[model samples]
Every structure is written in structure tokens, then in C-alpha cells.
Target: MAMIKTYRRDDDGVLHYREAWSEKSGVRTHMGAVGTKGRTRFHSTRSRTWPDKPTATEFLDNFTEESAADGYFPVPDDDHGWLVLQCWTFTADLSHPDDQRLFEHGQDALDEHLGWRGVGHYDGNDLGGKPPAGYDLDGTVMNLFCKVVDTGLGVKVVRSFARAFHLTPYHVIATREPGDDNDYVLAWSPRKRDKDFDLFRL
Candidate 1:
């Protein structure tokens, strides 16, 4: 696998990311917001930008340096964990049995819901079409796009789940998969789903 370099920046609460890597004959980059698939471009080794560098790796390293100087800091290599789209209910305090039971009930409800699973797709190749403002496409990250097989059942389940938890209806959370540092909410729906979720909303 080619070595990939990732970087992130925060602009007035919005998080954006960019990725660069070397290919056999070129260098590629993707830049956009944290969740959505962003735009991608390839710079062929035969281009003028490549003649000075001995290899694609060298060219990419030089490009990364320029990006860093422009305020994009490298994201830790271990940060490439999967993000999951699921239902979330509040648990005031896990140590309290009442909170535990409420949380368990929500979990059970989510697991028992029918037609809950959907076909998840990720960007494996550069795709065309304008992504909404502030979005990027990178093959290295776990950015998921879902299509529910049964939309009728899916919407009903979502509504029920929200009501059961006494949360504002018609919302869902895209959070870090079970055990990755913390249960960071990457994004949320029926609100500002296109933007990264606020990390300090505790």
C-alpha cells in the first residue's frame, strides 16, 4: 500500500481534512470537510512538477511540507479508525443504574429494530460530481455513505427510536465505532449533517 499523509484544520468550529499519497506514476490529493467524500486530483509523474523529484514519494513529501507550512497539521496515523452511523440516546451517568437501564434499553431497541442495516459504500476511486460546499473524497478514511434497502421501515424505526428516547425526532448520529479513543460524534442528521459534529457538545 502507498504511504498516505493526512492533515486536518479547524476553521471557526468546522473541521476539514486533506490527504496526499504517492502512486506508481503520479501523486494524488483529496481535500474537503471531515465527513463527506471530497474532490481528488492526480499529478502525473511526467508533468513538469515531477521532473525535479526522483520519485513520486519525493514529490509528495515536498507537497506535504508546503501544506504544513500553510497551517494543515498532520493527523496521527492511528486516527484512521472507522466511523459508524447509529442511534444515540443520552445516559446522564453510566454509574447510575437508572441511567444504565435507560441506555441499555435504547441499545436493545436499536439492535432489535428491523431492516436496520444498510449497504455502506466508501470512496474507492476518484468520483466526479460536485460535492456540497466543504466536502472531500479520500480513499484512506472510513467515510461512509449509506443506502437503506427498506426506506419505509428505516424511517419509521428512526422516528420510533427518537421518540422512545425522548429526543428531538428524526435525528441520527454518526459516531466513532465502539472503541476508538472516545465516542466522538462525527456528524448528525436532521440538523447540520453535512458538517462535522461539535466535539465539545457534552
Candidate 2:
């Protein structure tokens, strides 16, 4: 059997997939890059980088299978317009017995808020649609597009979602617009939780 490895260049962070096999002489033969990076459905043509670790692993897995059959795998080229968001819930908190319920509530809130705006559901593992290739949501991650303008407004939207789901502001993992590397925390809460809740009547 062949051993496959996926790696990114330290200088440019471009991912490469390669396969290796050991010979009888204790020498390892490494195959060339299996797939050519291309524009994915969830990314732009110029951005060939993997959005997350899971996505990179997914690409490697698919490339391994296809390379075995055809000697090469074609990278997908489409942008699904969805951004991945990592969510954390205090499942062990005694006060939050129904963590799953809270999660569902958050999903519902987000859906209701963004559904009519062309956004999709809070998919648990998959992207809920044909997410190009190699772009799937993690177990605790959800995907959506923020068509809600700036990051400040995005934070307000997140706060509203948290309130609707009866969750603290910390539950939302702050993220930026896909492809941006700035310190734009999309999810934010007020300094004084109690005061903010009172002010917003949440």
C-alpha cells in the first residue's frame, strides 16, 4: 500500500498532495503532486488555499481515492459563498442541561434571520449542498454567508442570535470575512453583559 501525505508550503501556504511507497531496498519513492490547485466553489479563483484543516484533509482523502483510479485528481472550481463558523457550547454546565436544544435554537435563529437572504441551514458536518470538493463543515462548525454589511453589524446580528438562543456572547467564535486576515471579530458582545441585555431588552 502507498502512504499519502498532504502538506502546505511554509512560504506561501499552498497545499500539495503527494504519495510515497517503500521499496525493497529501504528507499522511499515519492510521487509528484496529485492534484492541481484550482478555484473551489467556496473560494475565489485567485485563492487556492484551504480555508481550514478539515477542508485540506478532505481534499487529501479525495485526491488519494481518485489518484488511485485515474493517476490524477482535479481540484474543484466554484465558490459556494458560505463561511464556516466554529461554535462552542457549555454542554457540561449543569445549568445548561439541554445543550443540543440550545444549539438547535441557535440554528433556528440564524436560519430565520438569514434564510430569506439566500443563506442556508446550519449543517453539522456537510455543507448542506454540493460544497465544491473538499470543503465540508466540521462536527461543531456551521456555514453561512454574512450579507449583512460590515463587521459591526455582523456582531449585532450575532448578539441577536445569541439572545434568541439564550446563549452567552462567547458561544460564537469570532471570525472575519472569508479571505480577510484582519482582526475583525464578527461575533462580539457588550462589555457589561447585564447592562447590554437591559439596554437591548434582550
Best by lDDT: 1
Query: What value does the lDDT take at residue 120 in candidate 2?
Result: 25
Candidate 1 lDDT, 31-150, residue by residue in tens:
765433456797776557556544676667777787787677654434433333332222223344433543456445444332122211121211122222232311111112222222
Q: List per-prediction Cα lDDT, in the order shown.
A: 0.44, 0.36
Tell me how far the alpha carbon of residue 19 in candidate 1 is from the true structure, in angstroms, after superposition.
1.1
lDDT for model 1: 0.44
lDDT of 2 by residue, 1-202 (tens): 3334332223454323334333332223233321222222221111245333333334445556766565343222221122224343343231354446655455656655443222222433212221111323222323333433223434544555556566643333343443434333434423333211111111
CA deviation > 4 Å runs, candidate 2: 1-86, 92-96, 116-150, 178-202
Candidate 1 local lDDT, residue 75? 44
| Candidate 2 CA-lDDT value | 0.36
Q: How many clashes does each candidate structure show, in the order listed?
A: 4, 4
Backbone clashes in candidate 2 total 4
* Local lDDT at 155 for model 1: 42
